[model samples]
Target: MKRKHPELYEILVKTYQQDISESFKVDFKALMGKLKERVGRNSPCPCASGKKFKKCCLRK
Candidate 1:
């Protein structure tokens, strides 16, 4: 979806961030940091696309 529709993907991501922040009172940056710690840049992406995180979703 992201590759085919980058603008829509960004909008959805922003909306999701807002929803998470409002509903859980969570800090999105901090949450992303924790997630980044768990996934090495050279490791396979959590999205299961068989590509390294840095070359895949991390590009976003």
Candidate 2:
């Protein structure tokens, strides 16, 4: 929810869109999965670093 962290989520969502692209026009679950696998790594706080949710910040 960018409403909470407008600045951070704004950048994050932007980065997410750049990486996802138009091909991500699939289901919500699948899209979310890809997003986590892509930008949810380095982001330890929100774990949205373009990496797999399991292997992302979720681990550490």
Candidate 3:
């Protein structure tokens, strides 16, 4: 997974830990939106697919 989507892996680990609060749901959505905005179409899919996000799991 790391080899396929290093950026997403890094962010996921940095964002979520052992325990999260209920309020984190809001924060999580914001964080994910920010991430999607920050990532490029050429970036590897967060799902670990070796294809670009536009050609892989990204919703049309």
Candidate 4:
């Protein structure tokens, strides 16, 4: 999988790490806004595509 979308994955993973590491900051509005722009939105699907959260593998 490293051969596919390496740069995007790298940046996204790093951003997520940063996000999780800041869990106790008492404020997440700003951080969440930025993450939303970068990662898009997430919604549940009943089709059971069994993919990662942001992948939308269940969209089909």
Candidate 5:
């Protein structure tokens, strides 16, 4: 799939990294700030499940 869709592959990979990395101890305010900067509430979810942001990651 990645070879067929490099752009999408990149998005999926980035999203995966974001999810896993969030589990580690990190700055609170800075992380939220970065999330807001990078992920809009209505944007496609970072989970690679084709769901909207508000319906996915936000629910967690």
Candidate 6:
């Protein structure tokens, strides 16, 4: 089917890829937010930096 309709196949592939990427971005952000909430402001940064969460990546 795809070989018989290369243009349609390409369009479908591009649309599906875009939709998957957008969904992943949303899920990743939500996951990060949950993880961030689990870490305390005064806790050491997850990156192993001696700095506190509030002073490190949290500031970003």
* Best by the TM-score measure: 6
Q: Could you tell me how far off, in angstroms, the CA of residue 42 lies in candidate 4 after the best superposition?
A: 42
Tens-digit lDDT track for model 4 on 6-36? 9988988888777564565433344334443
Candidate 6 stretches with Cα past 4 Å from truth are 1-37
What tens-digit string does per-residue lDDT give for candidate 2 at 1-60? Answer: 768889999888778778555765445454455554454334443333555555644543
Clash pairs detected, candidate 1? none
Better of 3 and 5 by lDDT: 5
Clashes of each: 0, 15, 0, 0, 0, 0
Per-candidate TM equals 0.37, 0.27, 0.35, 0.28, 0.37, 0.38
TM-score of 4: 0.28
| Candidate with better TM-score, 2 vs 4 | 4
The superposed Cα distance between candidate 4 and the true structure at residue 35, in angstroms, equals 32
User: What Cα-based lDDT does every candidate model obtain?
Assistant: 0.72, 0.55, 0.67, 0.49, 0.70, 0.70
Error of 1 at 57 (Å): 0.7
| Model 6: lDDT of residue 5 | 96
Cα RMSD of all models vs. native, in order, equals: 14.1, 15.7, 16.0, 15.9, 13.4, 6.2
Give candidate 5's error at residue 27 in angstroms: 18
Kindly list the per-residue Cα lDDT of model 6 for residues 1-60, writing each as its tens digit: 699999999998888777565454334344446674578899886666698878877755
